[model samples]
Target: MSNEPDRAWWKEASVYQVYPRSFNDSDGDGIGDLQGIRNRVDYFDELGVDVVWLCPVYDSPNVDMGYDIRDYRSVMDEMGTMGDWEGLLDDVHDRGMKLVMDLVVNHTSDEHEWFQQSRDPDGEKDDWYIWREGDPDEPPNNWISLFGGPAWTYDEGREAWYLHLFDEKQPDLNWENPDVREAIYDMMNFWLEKGIDGFRMDAISCISKPHGLPDADTGEDWFDMDLYFNGPRIHEFMQEMAAETYENYDVMLIGETPGADPEEAKKYYDDGVDMVVHFDHMDVTYGPGGKWSPDYVGMETLASAGDDALDEMLNTMDLADLQEAIRYWDEGVGDEWNCLYMGSHDQTRAVSRFGDAHDYHRESATLVATFLLTQRATPFLYQGDEIGMTNADWDREDIRDVEARGQVDILMEEHDVPYETIAPFVRNRSRDNARTPMQWDDSEHAGFTDGDPWIQVNDDYERINAERAMADPDSIFHYYRRLLDLRSESEVLVYGDTEYVLPDETYPNVWAHRRTLGDEAVLVVLNWQDEPRDVSGVEGVESPVLFGNYEQRDGTTLQPYEARICDLG
Candidate 1:
């Protein structure tokens, strides 16, 4: 057994996300499994991530990775067996770490026994899933799926259209039924009884859809979500779920609701839920409008959201100013508007999305690491992010995300358009790029497993594997390790209050900030430019540099992608 503390130990520790498909694969059956994770337990223990937020590992049809659960009680056969999961859990506890699994109860697989029976023409479980009728002459409802299509899918055999907020394969559950809500809560107890420490709820608020099945030309872009996302009974259900598991066990629970209102979010935390993700975060680049502009926001739009809104946003941010708030999600959110960022099964890889290979990938990775590890909430580290992994090059033919691939096919076949025409847009939209295999060591399949992986590893894995990064002190791995150590040991960075220092008003690329505990403040600066610039922010520049990416001196010039941190009274 490892000498780590007990699972309760994570309150003071950091988490590392492990997306099964991309995490190391022990058996190499084209997917990552429990044994694959177990094989690297020692590495995790060494890196010192207190919790492992495993992406969905349940039995599923792989429609939305594991977000579309078929059997809440078991692991997918492709990933491993129930026994394998048990063993992995034991290993985690032995190392004094906790494991957080994805709780995808908002929807279930089309093949799930419940859904199958519900859709059966003459079955016992009818009405378990939301089944509706098509429009008199057009479609079912005006609601659009997150994957970009009608939320209702007609089942020919059943003569009814089932509701799916995501892929057609995932049918949303009807939480209005007492038995349904009870059963959902029962699943929480089931996992808790198994000694599971926590859950990352998937689309938990979508448990109930709009009461009335209103059709489109109805004027509203999305009638379902606006009407039901943080539904009337969502808080009630959350309270029941929390009372059953979270409140008593010191469990961490986070729900995934895209448009959840802040006031509504406070309900989850207030009802004894551990945390709720701050989704409005990704919306602040231009503020009010939520556009993703690389160039810093102009004063006009930035001012529109008001200084108060921006102040609260910057203060509650899970990462660096705007970018960290938008990027670096492995450090996910919790109750009380705490942010969660581990790339659950659905999101793209942090490295590829935020780090560019030709650009300051390593520097930016380190800067990002420093930013997230020392933030206000509990930070989560995604599986391969310790080594700064990048996304694999994608092709439409190589795409595997069900919704993305299906959409591409529909567009191509229906419109007779070239795949190349929408390839770039599709590439940005595909989830498969984030689902590739973990890059472990330089070997076949990057030492993930003996067999093929579910997704291909980034082609450059040969040079950017765990073994290589770990060997270099200046590497992303070492930098992350240092951050973990500092955050674990220092109160100022770990438990201190955060304040944002504006950029050198004149310079567009220089980002700076500070974290203060009592009178002591720690300043972090990043110069995202090719030519060196003046370090004019933060009045006092301590004599001895605390930590810097590039060498620093009085009136030091910052190089492109350079970052520096200073401690002051």
Candidate 2:
């Protein structure tokens, strides 16, 4: 609603997302905690990030790896006590950085006190969750949970069924209940009053559901996401929430919207959140079957792979579609805001997913960093991404993510999918890929923990650890540092209008874009191939190189996986 220029710290700041369980294990319990994060505040300071977003550390059963909240006010026992979290916040502030907590309000763990009381038919919190009287053998609707089975679970105690959009252990709360909304709002205020900066709202758009809970039109047994995502009262609830909490404090609010397009995202901003982390751009490589059937370079292609096949894999990504999505959000939101990120706790490693992580690791890593950092939106760097970390080579036995494991079971049981048929996709697209312990050094357990890591560390830690990166001037860590510095120093990079130069179909291996603010502009050219390519846009122009991955480059020729930023003043 406000088309004014954004001067807020969040708009200009770079966010570093740290998954606590995998970040670093300070207490050596094989799990990263608040103390671990506090111990590494200097690393964030050195990276020059303005904010650190810690994923859910709230009390949970770890059924869904912290997404299922048991207690909103208390920290997880494995993560540390509330005092440890407070100490971490103080350390981040002392290092001149802000900390944002992941707010998971979509559902609560079944073990939560509210849900426990709701289980009692005559209890005070009986209506706190969505409960319906239905046949004990049948669910109220044909809706399926996001994790895999029937959405409604029949509770023998109450002789009714409760709706759970995710895992059965995580029950969806009834937002229609005024007391529930008030409780959530009070929780928000509690964290705000505790000196935390803001919240990265988890699955926020899916909080509201249709009035009658009607069956989806998709004909499939599973609930259609469209039926519930950004429901009728979504904006009303968001506005009410903002009026109650966000409006009263100077803080940032970023909602994680799975199916939100630019227009829907604009609505979220209008309702008072700063921005929404939309997934359109990240899903460019998804095949017809979605994440389970991602279109990746085949083994045969890799065996006989030339520069062309490599280019085809990297360049064929619907970059043009990604650009359109970015432009749509920028134009649709006016001055609200948008988040630019290539990876997160739920997705695969960015360098491994988008860039050539094997052969041209450093070049591809910096290339992706350069492209993301120069964008108009606030850039988010996932932990371990700064040092070019890749996905862990895990077998089926090593899988830890509930969604991944559940999907595997569903595929095998329902779809007749063989282990070999689904394992490859799971290996490439599993959230566990990003959940591996942070590779801090080349020492045992990647220096993440003294004890055995909860998950296997990537074997390439010797070459990709942060310790080596910090010591090497030409490392990805330093490149990220320089990119962050550019954003800090140049106002154009922070608030510039984007202009895509080369279309994806025309120049499949090249992505060229210009960011301009008045007369000042920055041109970013990325060659996503494994072989040299000719760059043709800035011919005969006199623009000094602002940043580049490779050391030497002729004005027109680009090396393999090369990335360059030129100041077109």
Candidate 3:
């Protein structure tokens, strides 16, 4: 007999994002497949997640690690067949967990039939992609590609340049064309009918472009995403898509909106999109030069540096800025819900980026887990995060990610930068850090595959694998389970209002927030730094600890990277 509004299932559920290429390989092909995922349903149940979001497994050239998809209805040869996918879906459903597929509608591979047909200027599908006439040298405008070059690639067959916001092989779809939108909607419906619970739309903000492709107003050094990200027709297209495909079914929708602020995010929410993955908090470390500047850790490549060098790079990030960015979204979302995450395929490992991955890996990893789960939003836990996975210690020769390789090629080939000078920077920030094969056991290749892994496994796999974590009571994986259990059992954690404990104070190392429901409340205190912090000013330190990273605690003193969820008595 409560008066609270009825909420959707997604609002009360936690998501686990599985990057298929690195999750598990059942066929010994050194690549993760649908069968491998089907083989791990019990693990998902053990982890206590409600939804499993699979990254792209569609047919692809893998120029951008499956983002450059070649076919909408077909499965990748390496990722197994449509039969395997259907079987996997059935297995997930049998476990009472929902499966959400990654939706990549902004673009298609240059090898896609539509793009191939559009390559012919006189063909009926000529307008399927954005094509224009311009000087080959000028590239239609000064717009820089996200992969580090001109956005336009010249096509000899069409005698014109086609726009590719990512790698040249991934052509941006012309959503301005109604036929193109219809085709995408039909493909989505095909999957919806096949029993997917939802979709995690990839780079969805880039779908709508201005009427005319214009030159970037910014300089040539960085990306000019402002010109097209969350463009004019974005809301219209999203609404049309919802009506065409999602309106008929009860499903969740998560849009990956880059460069969107709180105000922009509300537009998607208003358009019936369930939630959005905004990058404001993720990009807090970027300086005026954005991701390419030395202010960011990934841009600093120390050729033979030690842990001290890495520590110095990590210190460039400001905790106050992080708090401000997080607070901006947390407060700005208003009645609309938010999606929370610490790491993903496109990001460096969360421990390496935001916590001390080397010295206090366990403490920092658990601390981040508490922060992610205790918030008033749906948490999406990336694969390998449960076992406290850290970034791979990679060198230039070990690089495989398309974006990292593109940066290296640009620095060394175009700018004559030394390989040694930029190699470490790329390693520290490579997307491959998160894409490393899952650490399942202490055996060869971390038991991800009997064959050689597509990417190198982390050297610390012997200590961080899942088998070891499951057996140890104090392991990071267990802490995640306990946190999820706490969330599932407490209504306040899921439906309460969050209020920062020390709003006007200057305590940079401490993050204290209270989640309060009608008659229940809990306080989450976290020390974000690797030093002892004075949280005595917070009145609830003496209260009984509901859950914590440390086994024992003393009054008012929080150890380095310590976290506590205390009942506010």
Candidate 4:
């Protein structure tokens, strides 16, 4: 709210993700293009999402969306002409919103010119990829690719196995090679120089793989090192990258380090790496005894996760560790936190996984929002999440994520299960559960497209689209807009010290966290259940309801799933 701007712009700003292939299609090609993103830059500016994290539109074979990089410099042939990319950058900046690109340096598609040449044993660029000879009957070490089977794939021409942490076609780059690192930094600098703001690093934490190819302890033909997740020299290399590629420019690094151990996880923000898409806290929300557990539905009425579950989940897992993750970065190397919500292209929709999206969605969504926005980091809002988007109707053939499809098939085959038993599991676990096109309207294709979509749109789009939410004051979209507005206007929500309160007699389903900045205190209270509740923490001076899904009198009873930000007394 102050006239003075940007002590930490990324921290204060709201980020909206653009999955380019599905965002909006301009050429009637069924896939969304960069121009589609260009068309929506103004929409983002008006919607109050200050940052735009664009999913890869880079030239690729489209094996894993756009993650399999073929050429880092060229825009995808499907996305648009290079002229469209230039115009797209101009449009984003003209709207006063920041643009972020996906940095996927772990591997490149087989078709990439580098990989093609690297496969030739006699070629000068042969050392660019990790390739080694295999014993006649055996394989090249006992290393399995993170994707599924063996990490090393035999190349017919070279008669040697090449390291590929993912799909065999996308060979891992040997970053130890100075030329490779220089190429990556130069590619980043190329984009940064092209007026792009920054990047959202894909599998960034996996960049510094342990040089000595190590084997997994699982006693299988697989190699996975504790070091691979967070290698010894990662910080050094990343800092070097920041200095060479992103140092001079105003860029934000949002890292996605999946399934990282707590120790290695903190390394993300070390060396001034900005915000990390960490999942330590998120794992707490999973079901060792959640609804899917056979015992859960049988239990008459479940105890609120706010009370019983909080104590159980947080007892072993540190509530303060989240703050610790961010603080470790602040104290060690100076950098900010990246705030986030429950959904991404890789994550299931918040409503689908966290709570019953059908009935108690308001309460569940508000509880998650309060937790995400009120925390000390910067916040990124997934597309259609503001309107409380849920997963597509649960099924198997409908799935889209390549990883989930292959893994689920393997799981089902091992269990000797019928498709019925496996379908729901895949539905719950698949990334495609989140990648369904943005729910824009109640029209055919949810107003996302006039043509057929690459992925199925959620059936409830008629009821859950943006048009309906934007019109209704109580809609989740309106609540998010209000929250984004409040975040834009208040420093307390952005960087305040948090104080959690144990729920007691008054509000049974509420999870309250007090955020304080010196004398100013902000109380964000969320109703996490489908029942009415009352709370008693606002015991100070003339209190005002700063924001809420429902309009409540000073002492009015809060309905199920109500959310409110009240001024501290």
Candidate 5:
């Protein structure tokens, strides 16, 4: 028998996520299409990414920005036709890169044919969605929607209330129905036959619900997610889907599981998915009020505050908590895999969230890139993060995300909070931050569109853009390129065991770890603060610095937001 352990291509490959609507608008329609993405395949090749996870481009009203999918096989008219999508696939494959489409199977747009049929009282597809009959004055249960309303929406036609965990435009599919599972499996097979490499399963864990749709025991008004998130039948559904589709093809499966822990994730891995994206590490800095409250401090505050101010902020920060979360997965997952990322379509920009987006933009951006790339898990680079994109400076009127607008309405109507009080928090944590147009150049609309862009381009595009970064050898773009190259070439980085040299609690601002594969080992040291700090607790100090943000390093200290990778072999 061969002694070598089995490995998959996705385990070692790096993925780049492209939010389709904001990537580029080639037709001057202010909306990015498949042709626009096809035009940018060369950029992906140059960046050295192995896979591109394209966000949803399916036919929809865009109520949740394409998450409310109207059709499974058809492309959106604004995005392009099936022909254009095929051409984009060819272009991606031609460049030696693979493309992964977003698989949104948890819910379907209310306008979807299946949903419309299911809404009919005597239709054959009546059981295709979750429906219950109850008093019109009150919902079936006390469950609240994720978008800040009642989860159940009454359908006058069927005289029933349909469950919608998200927007009312999106009705949750009844996975318990064998016919629904078969239909979803057929859709997956259709795409797999279309030549795409894999799928980035969106909200995969939310497919299952508790045995009884009971009211949650919570002190707050909002429904507790524990009743539905990763509930009773998650593993069964995933296993069935995997056995019917993913297992038959040589494709990657990445599940976006928000509430899944290391143990729960291992179950999914055993069922069939290749990797899971957990969100515990990302929630460290969230205050007691969660993501919507104004009590949490923003990244801009951390970057500009003084030592005393920073100390107070550090108390509220979750550096140690984040480190523990990563370590737990690294140890608990065993041979299974996990995905590493600093930002995504649903979150703020990585550079603006974890790195300094102000004076030390370049250094801090590169530091975060290096930290993520050197980890043992597969790293995903969000769109424009390679060029150090910052969050959009959007005003109240500029915001277009449905979730944000709903939250604002809830705060005003229910809590009696003034609009001004919550506007700052909305700006700091809105999904719109990562939904702005890509800054390709310093053109009228940052070279993203020839005509009017859908969202306003960042004003700093003149100083921070792909054109300038590609021209400069020391830019964040080139740093990311080099980091990807290093990961591709280093076996230790791809499959090594990670060991923390300085735990987060001991030195909260400094994240230091060592990755070891047999006799070969590499040390990664990153300073999360804005001030210089002495590096300690690491045994091997005489190793050569393989990569660093600063040109000159004293070997014993790291400059503000400095990142260093040293080969200890």
Candidate 6:
């Protein structure tokens, strides 16, 4: 009898994340709606993606861009009605693709009915949110919000303080309250019953809070993550939630865990999450002081900030750090599954961040695609990434992301930091870089809308739109489609065990790895930098080149930003 682990659909699936506001604008209102998604259903099919992970389109105040949910069951008016969402779900299903909704139950908009009712201190829903009694001037604790300012907000009507880990308008739910958990489960079931595939739970690790909600013991500059993250009853809450909702249906549950390491990530699987979106690889460049620190932007001090700071950068995503993180999770998960990604709605463009966008745009983007698809995990391709989208060139006045604005506000208000000093770093690392409208064509507004767009389209749309890419066989879009097709046909690539080769110290700019399944092995060689490298010394480097980004095959030297998948039988 075979001892191989049981096969699951999610383990073998590849996901495509769609940011609704920027995916496609159908109403010409400049914002993408459900109908717009329905219009592009054929695109998902053409790309051969197995799952479409839709970002939150629920009723929201647009604070934090729909992360703060006002109504769980109602679809936002701008995104269209419930009928539009149902049509989208059906369209996706008809194409043999699954649809996963973004679950943002960690917090709700202050305008939520539950929060509104909770304001009446004597009401039954008073404890629905994390409310505490304290002096008006001083909060119950000294916890700092992840966005900016104190974590607590004064509620004049209730004469109490409420906790908001993100924007002040987004109040954290009291998961400790059984009633709150029940309500969330009911909401999940409602969506599941409607035939949706699964959920991508947002800020899921922050669902449970530590007892007493203590203040920070570690200095003043901190989000107090240690106090609130991976809380005491996190496992219990997750297990309960799963048993009550997802376990009843054939659905997958993926969690967004920010600070979790490999061992910590394993617990989520036990807590009923099929897999977790780990930050090990993503947060590699974030300094010890966190994302906004000067070290993250390659600056030792803001005093030396100048117009050429970006060109004189010292810090960037380290290959060694990325390798270590990827290898750790790849091995740490054991027989369990993993979610592989290099870009997301909250991150900068993959080609710009990890590849040489200015020098080897096509080579680097296709190389990055090769890296993700050839891994031993279910890969998630972010919207526009397949078309080799680059980050936006936003100036200080063009910044639209709330996270960037909040960080800027904090730095200026508390530390008296000048806007000019932080503008370059913000422009490079802002989430808005990934939120730009999808470039469908080279027409006006890049064919995204007839009216004004919600966010500015990347200025390079004329050269990098999908229409141009599809017409070219050698474009990044076609490369992605080929990789997806190859991945679907090869079980070895999906179920193979990974082995890292060429130690980071010896080959710092090259990523050489082997995926082996029984006697079949595929060697994936990636030249991560924009310079030719001698890869002849690597094991199995002479094997048959099953696939590669370059037209000419070099047995000894790998071209700049080149990638190859070699079959070694």
- Give lDDT for model 1: 0.67
Which portions of model 2 miss their true places by more than 4 Å? 1-5, 219-223, 294-316, 414-417, 537-542
Compute the lDDT of residue 104 as modeled in candidate 1. Answer: 82
For the record, the alpha-carbon RMSD of candidate 2 to the native fold, in angstroms, is: 2.9
True-vs-predicted CA distance for residue 382, candidate 6, Å: 0.6
Clashing pairs in 6: none
Reference-based TM-score of each model: 0.86, 0.94, 0.96, 0.87, 0.95, 0.96
For model 4, what is the error of residue 211's alpha carbon versus the real structure, in angstroms, after optimal superposition? Answer: 3.9
Query: What C-alpha lDDT do the candidate models reach, one value each?
Result: 0.67, 0.84, 0.86, 0.70, 0.85, 0.87
Q: For residues 1-569, write the lDDT of model 3, one tens digit per residue.
A: 13263477898899999999999999998999889988888999998999999999999999888999999899999999999999989988998989999999999999999999998888999999999886766678777778777788999898889998888999999999999999999999999999899999999999998767777778644766678698889999999999999878888999999878888999998887898998877876555555544434443344455655754574356766777777888889787888999999998888877788878999999999999999988999999999999887677888988888877777676545677766555656678889999999999999999898998999999988999999999999999998999998888888788887743356767888998887788999999888998787887876889999999787789999999999985
> In candidate 4, what residue range of length 10 has the lowest lDDT sum?
294-303
Candidate closest to the true structure, highest lDDT: 6
Residue pairs in candidate 2 whose N, alpha carbon or C atoms collide under 3 angstroms = none
Q: After superposition, how far is residue 252 of candidate 6 from its true place, in Å?
A: 1.5
Q: What tens digits encode model 2's per-residue C-alpha lDDT throughout 83-103? A: 999999999988889999999
Compared with the true structure, what per-residue lDDT tens digits does model 4 show for residues 321-434? 433443443333323355555678877777666555766776667656766677667777788778888766446776667777677666567655555544444555567767
lDDT of 4 at 407: 73
Which residue ranges in model 6 land beyond 4 Å of their true spot? 1-5, 219-221, 296-315, 413-418
Cα deviation of 423, candidate 5, in Å: 2.5
How well does candidate 4 match the true structure in TM-score terms? 0.87
Candidate 5 — which residues are off by over 4 angstroms? 1-5, 296-316, 414-417, 504-506
Candidate 4, lDDT over the whole model? 0.70
TM-score of candidate 5 against the unseen true structure: 0.95
lDDT, candidate 5, residue 24? 89
lDDT of model 5 at residue 217? 77
